[model samples]
Target chain A: MINAPSPTQSPSTTVPGRLETRGASRSAATLAFAWRTALRIKYVPEQLVDVVAVPLVFTVMFTYLLGGALAGSPSSYLHSLLPGTLVMTLVLLTTFTGTGLRSDLSSGVHDRFQSLPVWRPAPLVGALVGDLGRYLLASSIVFGLGLAMGFRPDGGVGGALAALGLVLVFAHALSWVWIVVGISVRNVSAVNAINIGVQLPLTMASNVFVDPATMPGWLRPIIENNPISFVVTATRGLMHGEAQLSEVLWVLAIAGALLVVFVPLSLYKYRTHRS
Target chain B: MTHPVIHSQGLKKRYGNHKALDGLNLEVPSGGVYALLGPNGAGKTTAVRVLSTLVPPDGGAAHVLGYDLVRDAHTVRSKIALTGQYASVDIDLTGQENLVLIGRLLGLGRAGARRRATEVLERFSLTDAAARQVRTYSGGMRRRLDLAASLIKPPQLLFLDEPTTGLDPRSRIELWTLVRQLVSDGTSVLLTTQYLDEADQLADRIGVLNSGRMVADGTADELKASVGGGSLQVRLLDHEQRDTAAQLLGSQLKAQPHLPPDPAVVEIPVIGSEAANDALTQLHHAGIDIISFSLGQPTLDEVFLSLTGHPTATEELA
Candidate 1:
């Protein structure tokens, strides 16, 4: 049973009814929530498995299994395989954010957040910002594994860093789409199902693992025009120091369009749905 | 006159043909606990949500803390906190971290937030488990933390929706004590509960909600008295003697004697001590052996039954 605060240990100065006025600006609070989300990974260390161990395993397995037939050697295959794996790994991790948001809704945390005096979209935006850490960790592991396995980037350190920045921006923008799905879906499983359903098709039909020209004629258009293809090709070009402006612009345009459509859509759905 | 902390008129909300709240009105004064007692689906939670500015009512106006609910929702939100039916603290965060996060969101600086979190943790006796994630805390501990979080910047009014619904006896008593402490410090609380005894224990005034309407509202004694003066419960030694004793008591009291599911007991409504005495003498003269007899004021359940034509869902479940 709870007891009254003893006079000797009373901390009346910080009690309720004393403090007035909002404490932090909307953006600052959003950032604070983002920081809190990232901090949760510290307690649930298993969250790192998707970003760290999965990337290492995928890179090693793919490089060893297909490298001999496709690129003549494992080390040679990593030049192309690493960037594709990075895109696949980062994209897959975004589903976790959607599922996380769905669970937050189910568990009533979303209601608590909505009732607070903070910015309405802070929770959603903060979640996206927090997820950037996972994307960064996964990218670094893929790149580092490639380097350790005798893969080198001709685009030098600056080019490699730029490619990373582009991938992070793209992943961040793509998360808004998932956030919209998260808000609209009925359950966490549905969110995961929809996200995986959309992501696998986008990734496989793109020029990630194999050359678009080698694919059958009917499948060539999808492989050539796919947005993931644009991102992957841009990343490869940047990391190889032979960057293409058209492909980079295409990736940027797709990211901008996704943000423009989904951010407001998510906020609108969040406002309308009491649950 | 000073405005009440919460005032609503003709509050109406509907969910696709189901009227959660219909033409309801409420007035809650400052600095005391006002309990809204009702069964499930009686619109208690809906009323709380509307007053707290979480759900907008379709056809009513409300002022919470003197701010119009619709026009100045941000102001209302800043002045009120709601601890809902479910524990709303983040399960992934430690108890201390949950408080700190809410504090920072409420506009406190990092250091100020940490200091406030520490104070709340200590006040709620959660300092020992402050570093553990909320998922690991027991139900009582989680509920205490939920209440503590609502007090991070205590508002003038607090809304607790079924705050002790699933707690054990000891935890329920502890929460009742904490609510009393909060009320003593001048926070007006509007609570909803199905526990009749809970309302009897904590509320300065109680409102009985039935099917989207305020069926009755008064202090516990007043509401109980409204049902009738009192009730006399008679337990006969022989189960076979129940019908004759009930017949004699019913005619003497000029009221129906209620036969409960138990075969050995009969309950009679009495207007006063004189009525009870007349019935007792009548039973003795009829050679009815009474093992035990007691006269008591009507309970809230009886009041609810008289008003709503059915026992409260909690009583039925019990």
Candidate 2:
């Protein structure tokens, strides 16, 4: 075993000065943590199977399985189905963020981060930022595969890009909901359970796969007014060159409101929550 | 007298109805290792957490590196690093990445962080595994990397909570050597351990904690001396003669012999070398055939048992 120190070694008792310029800024360090988290998908490719394979499988299955019944033909349905599937797939991927955060919290990594001198919110903020990549990846896969399966947007490239931007912004804001759940929940499995409970109902109840006009009179209002419905409607409007300023604004307003409430709520829980 | 590197008085914390830490006081002078030896659930980890600013204490006051733990927590955080009982480095990141991340968080610039990562990796003999993910590392390598991560800036003080809890003997010794080097270079370490030998081997001063209180604090020798000096242990060849041996030694040494769970062994405390010799001579003069007799200094185990009336939880489990 290691023993006493040798006499030749000098005891350097000088304390270094406070590092004024040496440390990275809070935002920069947080981004670095986020980047590292996203980069971990490279080592564990199974993480990507959800973003890559799920969107393709769901879009193909739903587009073919329900296309004739929901619309006149598969080609006509693709126009609406592709945009709706994009929103649904991106929303589903947000749950992984909660599961990842819960895992980190339970594994004692949070304790290490808590004891560090860095700003307390960096880990949570960085995690949200890192998950942006997953959201983007899922979006591209759904869109790219839609193009391959003979679906074309009436909206030009710019309109399609705009729609993608809106969905991403909405998904980004919606992530705070999961982030809050991630921090407050007891475990990863619990976070997954709660997120699925919230996500599945929102996706199914919205106008994702079918037009609300064909639904029962009582269900039309709930489906048409669902937040997911607003996003899917706005995205379809933009992608079909039928964009409306009010629908886009409504989506933005909801995204902004989710951000306003849940960001602070998640931050508050991040600061106070302990295991 | 120089101010202690760490000082706490009447520190208190409770979890619901159970007291995790109860009016505990501690002092550790600068430039050496101070080992807090206690059993599981004795509040050693709680004390470390409170001092390291991971958890706030419900009552009392503490100063670490001359800064108040609560009010001046930022200053204390800047001056200290903690390696928790678990290897807290990111498993997904490479060992080098873990160090660089900590370095950058500690305010080392990008280039500076890289340089420090390289240097600490070399110091811990982890250069070979620096590029590998920590998830692939053995327990010892991960621990070394964990310690290395905490040293990114070499704080004035470090908190090592059970640094060698599950390490193999060689790795344990290597960590001890590294700690000794760190202490020699003027770093103050507040280490908590259930292993008595670890404290005896590293601590310049040892503090015995039981039920969230410091029951004794002194150098190893002083604590041993307080427990009535060294002991003479005699083992009889025949189990039938054990009672006769205990009685004979009890009378010869004028002290009650302590019988551990084993029946063939008798342990008597002796004042000095002469008394030890007297006991051995008296045993030899008797008709009992001795299988073995040895004069030895009281180990911290005995000191711990004498002070607490029971072995540490780890020892009990062992």
Candidate 3:
């Protein structure tokens, strides 16, 4: 308060003098917004309800309900279903990124962030960074439950860790598609509905819950070509210690393609979106 | 005169053919409240958005705080702050965290941001609730936090887009007091409000907007004169004496007396305080007992009807 500039000097100087001689670095601003997201989760622990509960429910329900019929035994089904459900949980969590963003856009908070002098994309990028942590949480929950249910990986801890890394990269890239949806959509429910419409087909119709081999001929190609199925195949390979470089490269290409296309579209919509 | 803090020519913006801002021009001098008054959908928020560099104009040019709006937008953004219509503070974060976030973004160090946040929370009387999430705070508290965020660095120019739109009368007055203090410290402010009384009370000059263009602009009194003038309303003690009272008041005020459906009330436009005073005294002298009297400034509805030939919407603008 003591060093505050007097009123007479304001108009002449134009720019209001500040205590901080330099602006915050782009990384610092991004981290600051990430801190905001963390604080939000801390205050409203209920926001993490779906992250924790959904994964637990899916892991238990699928392993017990249809595991015996699908794989000829409940325990054996855990071997196949664990990796698939892990992909399903995290990849589906990416949809929430759009729903969160859509609400932020309408909350008037987005306008304030946009008006800031910091790096322009910091807020959106910061939110994406926070979503990475959420995906990590969901991954650990599914993996932790499977380990407790007598599910063991052939590749041991190293293979499981690699699988987790692949899921994160893929889920992180997929969030951009939802970020565009969040920014361009008019309301929150629309983002939610779109998430369900997109998620149901990808999670159910793909090779996540069962092998595409037993499917009718026409359905097999769709499941095999599905990107989620590619991610699942990549995940199963990593966890079982038999990962093919071509499969790894394919998953990388799909993730890279999503980042290349939707990242620009999301940022553009964020910058120019009309109220 | 010193260079105006804001000067723009033909500022145009269109939202899918709605023409939110259609070739509008504006100039606001530094160091006082300059209000933009208009009906809903009259481009008030759009103008604030464009000037604050949140949204780009489709055409036209603007200079804010002596920097070009489009070419030097980053410089302009550094010099200005905006408190949007919705209290833009993060509700899930505590008041302390919200202030710290804004301070850190504005370039303050960790310790410096915490210290500044403490001072700001105290100044805004939120120190007790600083640890609570903003969602727990009442509407007034949220708005105060929003304004506090805007003043984190004492920006050279502050844009307040309908700051007190939904606040109660007491809260509105409290916010007004805060704004007055900021102006006294010499922070130039450009505010928009749908209430004419708000503009009249706070603004040194006003621009009345209609359908994206500024239809009239000047001091409050000049605006009143442009729409004829303020009005004098008298509630009669006896409804039967209304005719005689109107005759006496008309002869004294020299304006046509407009008798509304209320038989006991007579309303007429008043140009000056002296004439209104004379009319009041004339009623007293004639022994026409008056139940109550009020000198009413022109409302936004009246202003719009006179300037644009239609009444403004009763709903919130901006």
TM-score computed on alpha carbons, candidate 2: 0.87
- List, for all models, the DockQ compared with the true complex: 0.39, 0.34, 0.43
Candidate 2 ranges beyond 4 A from true positions: A1-22, A196-205, A212-226, A243-246, B240-289
The regions of model 3 sitting more than 4 angstroms off are: A1-22, B229-232, B236-264, B270-301, B310-318
Per-residue lDDT over A57-130 for candidate 1, one digit per residue giving the tens place of the 0 to 100 score:
86788789988788898878888877777777787778767887888887767767777788877888787788
Error of 3 at A248 (Å): 1.6
Report model 3's TM-score to 2 decimal places. 0.89
lDDT of 1 at B126: 88
- Model 2 docking category: acceptable
- Tens-digit lDDT track of model 2 for A89-200: 8888788778878887886666776777777778877887888888787777787889899888899898889999999899889888988888888899898787567787
Candidate 3 per-residue C-alpha lDDT over A87-148 given as tens digits, one digit per residue, 9 for 90 to 100: 98887788878877877778888788777788888888888888887777677778888989
Summarize candidate 1's per-residue lDDT along B34-149 as a digit string, tens digits. Answer: 99998889999989888888778899888888899999998888888989888888888999999999888888878888998998888777899999999999888889999888
Top-DockQ candidate index = 3
Clashing pairs in 1: A16-B154, A23-B107, A24-B107
Number of clashes recorded per candidate: 3, 3, 0
